[model samples]
Target: MTTVVSTGSYDYLTSALTTMPTPVTTSSTWPQVPRWLTLRQSLRMARDPVGNLNKVLAAYGDTVHLYLGGVKPSIVTRDPALVQHILQKNHRRYHKSDLTHGLLRYLGKGLLTNEGADWLRQRRLIQPGFHRQRLAGLTRLMRAAADEWVAELAALGAAQGPVEVEAHAAMTRVAFRIVARSVFGDSLSDEELMQLSDWLTAIQLFYVTTIRQPYLRPVQHLRGRYRQHDDLARRLRELVRAAIARHRTAQAAAPADAAPPDDLLQMLLDARYEDTGEPMTEHQLIDELNILLVAGHETSANALAWAFFLLARHPEVQDRLAEEINRELPNGQEVEFAGLPRLSYALQVVQEAMRLYPPAWIIDRVATEDDEFQGVAIPKGSVFSLYVYGVHHHAGLWPDAEAFRPERFAADAQPALPTYGYLPFGGGPRLCVGSHFALTELQLVLIQTLRRYRVLPTAETPPGMNPLVTLRPAGELRLRFEQR
Candidate 1:
């Protein structure tokens, strides 16, 4: 049997790794759940990891050591302070594990995978792409994308009363459109957009499957599954390359005085390094485009899907949101980036929805050198799963953690949030560069959709958690759209 040394409030953990239920000792300071126990609970954990981990943490304390997949030794923590230390304050001591770098095999070395001074350089170079004025310029593209989806809903529900739609599929299309349009402008066609979405989905699905079931590597290699996915990734790169080529050709063909399109691709092409006074090489630019497309698309889609799901379930919330949105963007005015602050309730709802179901559910980091935080010892090469989902849901961090209360994020809300309690966007120096663009895009989508249709809950039960590369609903999420 695996013995739990302690279990108590995370606050006291500053004094020790954690307080135990049984007698504590120097050797047992960091208690490990027996491999056998981890293996025994493997099937259950696979089905409901969030719930299963919650049970283990409740018994073992905020942090515990265990074998991931009954094989690899690692520590999982729901402690906000620990998460903050790894991602921010003491981040230099930690780097992403192969678990994240593995994406480089398929996606290439972009900002998400780059490390050290190079990653810092790239961050500084790319930071300005999302500056306030830049995002304000992109709002038109976002609103256009959102309006198209809303128009589609109106068309669908116009003929049929309360048209039934799959929220995940719908949101996925809209999110992809928004990102694709923002990145490439009119460079890609609808068919190409669809193809890109399919390819990215396939690549991500295969990558996560391999990561989760490491034992399948040999079999996958022999079966040529890896080869097949690599081919898909190659084709994806080619499509992006073609877009770049087209942009270059057009830029060359345009009049010398004419301005190029105001989009992410243009921003990347124009950006020059501070020290070198040179733009990124074509290969580096392509890698970033790939990363941005994937990062910007899937995460936003999942978040949007969850937001609509919550709104459908909580009609009262939708009503309040409608009232607020109406009061702010009255007369059907579109969501301009500058006016986002006025839609405070919409922002709160988005914040709360992410708190309940964060897209980046878990983040993996490894200690680059031996380090210690509080009283816990972290040796070099130690693997840590900063369970962002767990941190968001930890009762000690959020009162009534399981409840859907958007007011918790209100301007004058009581009991302010803990340092790292919320991580809808992974925090620290790497806090998503597109955070402003994403928040603006999400609020726009919500407001536009609400203006056109009332997202009503269906008879279907709640969707199960499908924690893959990102947190997604296990299966299709169906909802009804009653045109308002």
Candidate 2:
């Protein structure tokens, strides 16, 4: 039987005890009585998860039981072994949790939110599109986009004194353009890209509020929040429809002898189900595209912004990185797809930055069947949060966890980590399909940006975490760009 622990009793019990509570003993039955958060604590957590999570870590150690009002108790864990068990070892017994289910309103049944057999099928079909060779072919397109952004920054730097820019916003525009060019090819117009970006930002904000604070749902509904979200989603769908129509028209206009352009949109349009040999319907295609647009750009943008922020605060590391980039690609030369491997320091810098500030800060999963780990009973339907941020910062896992040391990720110096300890892209069969894509983009952008300008810290250099749909800067990450 599940015992409901009241917050008042927990506080009394803790206060009454003179010594630290004994560690829970291993047992077939549920091991220890869980400590529940008070209603006030739950509300504060919803508003500031990263801050509260840090507090919980300090108070409860690696694992904690959270009780959100009106919702079932959930477990949050930072233990690498438990994380590995949930994400890799026993992955089949678990599925994407309600946290992702809440995204269905915005993303629909796409790869990011879809579950079970359909998700598996879609993953298999789309996997080929992100293969290394396919991504390699798009290197020139990626470089071209990076070059355009760098040139724009150059113009800004020349026109202004140490041009101040919001790194997150700037990176979002660049990343979105790269995804648009890579995925939809030339089918999307500039206006359409801007509209899609705006809509996505609105939808993300709406999602964060509704999902995090269920208690506020009534208030949000009264404010027509859902209507605003629906309107943005409708406009986005129309944009996708228009792009698809353009692709179809281009295909029709081409001569029979001419081959259609090899792009992500064409790739998806040409893909067929293995068992049924059927293609995705227009709606399905749109959903998949929406997922790509949302997933493809946002995470990369946050990561790039954070990487820049870290580099700005650590100028010595930035100087070393710039030196390496200059040695590899002298005089701001165009980056070749084949030459990416040579930029090892730049790659290390990106990896270390991601370690400190993983964009996908938390991963949630729900068990399909009752299970136990280390004598703790995990009931079926129990929500498990794999706290990526916590694990990355866990003192036991990495020495000097709070310090930003890119050298720690250097090939020769990198330390061994537990299976699930470093999950920037997550793990197991469901590992982010865009991992290689994102890494490549970060490398190119870093190479281009540093080669052109020195990213210096301003008053807002080291930004705080926002912890929304993704971990973004709590506020504007303002930085100065001085032309090198």
Best by lDDT: 1
Error of 1 at 271 (Å): 0.6
Residues 1-484, model 1: lDDT tens digits: 0011012244533433334354222543566777899999988877788888888877777778888777878889888878888988899999999988999988998999999999999999988988988888889999999989888877775436798889898899999999999999878888998999999989988998898889899999999999999999899999999999988888888899997787899999999999989999989998999999988998999999999999999999999999998899889776777788888999989989988999989998999999998777789999999898988887666778888999988866766666777877888888888888888898899998897688888898999888887889989999888877
Name the 10 consecutive residues with the lowest summed lDDT in model 1.
1-10
lDDT of 2 by residue, 398-431 (tens): 7688999887766556355434667888887788
Q: TM-score of each candidate?
A: 0.94, 0.91
Clashes in each model (backbone N, CA, C under 3 Å)?
5, 0
Ten contiguous residues minimizing lDDT sum, candidate 2: 1-10
**Which regions of candidate 1 deviate over 4 angstroms?**
1-28, 158-160
Best by TM-score: 1
Error of 1 at 160 (Å): 4.2
**List of clashing residue pairs for candidate 1:** 5-20, 5-21, 6-19, 6-20, 6-21
| Regions of model 2 farther than 4 Å from truth | 1-37, 68-72, 256-259
The lDDT values for all models are 0.85, 0.80
